[model samples]
Target: MAIFTMMNSLAALLLFLISSSSLIAASDSPFILAHKKATLNRLKSGAEKLSVSIDIYNQGSATAYDVSLNDDGWSSDIFSIISGNTSTSWERLDAGALLSHSFELESNVKTVFYSSPAVITFRVPTKAALQEAYSTPLLPLEILSDKPRESTLDLAKRALAKYGSLISVISIVVLFVYLVATPSKSGAAKGSKKKR
Candidate 1:
């Protein structure tokens, strides 16, 4: 009789744990957000750099979900992870040592955008995962701004314009340093004469 009672107690505990886990997953499944998009057409010279600006608040709600970019014929010229204002509050992913980086989400009334950023292929642990985790549908995300407009020339021009001054300054400084550090022919000859 004691053995049977023990078995019954164990089964009840297991059922309770499963039910609670499912309830939690359900709550977080359906999360969503709204984001805005703009394009600077002149800078995308054979490169894809997309900037995302979340201008509005509570535009979309979803449980924790993932993002994915269309990956057909795709390559990342420069893959980067950047932070906006909510760096201290968001949970980060563990990609491994040497590859570990933060993937924090933007918060209310804050904006985060990537500069000459590579297009993302996707974000993992999808909506289904959220459902499984919390037994709720993934949160819904509403894109607030117009969808990203495609203009290769505009992207290239924009990129050049934004980074142009920095590039020119670096070039000038490098040239000046080279001229100062390299000995001219006359200087070398004068040094030999002085030695004699």
Candidate 2:
């Protein structure tokens, strides 16, 4: 009877362990997705610039902790984060919530085409999480160098549109000064006839 009782206790312990482990795994796993969109613009000085926008979405039922973008693949000389924070201290993203960030990168190299991938890492919640992290696959971004050139006529038209009122005022002032300085046409003709 004692042997049978020991066997039953072992079975109970095994069942408890299995149930507890499953519960722990469910609570410690959070699902997240990262989306990236980039726009490339070439400046008038022939420098290429990129504006990148990132959106992170949490699809699980748990909140993500210490979320941040990993910069292992990004080179500072090639790309710079002009805006947004890439650090872990930004904020905790809740379930079904979305976090957005924007960055501007300028490259001196002209007529270049390249692709960069984005990786995001975050922590899952636990009783004592201890910074256990998860990462998403590399989100690929394509960068193309294509900027429309402004012709000289287009530049002049823009300038004229911007300063049209000021130019008109100056022109009116100059015309009034010329009229005051010179005699009238009729008076000039009469004076010439009298001289004759």
Who wins the TM-score comparison?
Answer: 2
Candidate 2: tens digits of C-alpha lDDT, residues 27-125: 645567777666777677766677766778776678888777653445666666666544334468888788887667776754344444466667765
Could you tell me every candidate's TM-score relative to the true structure? 0.25, 0.48
lDDT of 1 by residue, 1-196 (tens): 9999999999999999899757744553332222333332222233223333322111112322233221111112322323332112123222211111123232221123232222222123543332211111222232122357869999989999999999999999999999999989998999999999
What C-alpha lDDT, on a 0 to 100 scale, does residue 167 get in candidate 2? 100
What would the TM-score be for candidate 1 when compared with the true structure? Answer: 0.25
For candidate 1, which ten residues in a row score worst on lDDT?
Answer: 92-101
lDDT (Cα, 0-100) at 139 in candidate 1: 26
Local lDDT at 17 for model 1: 85
TM-score of the candidate numbered 2?
Answer: 0.48
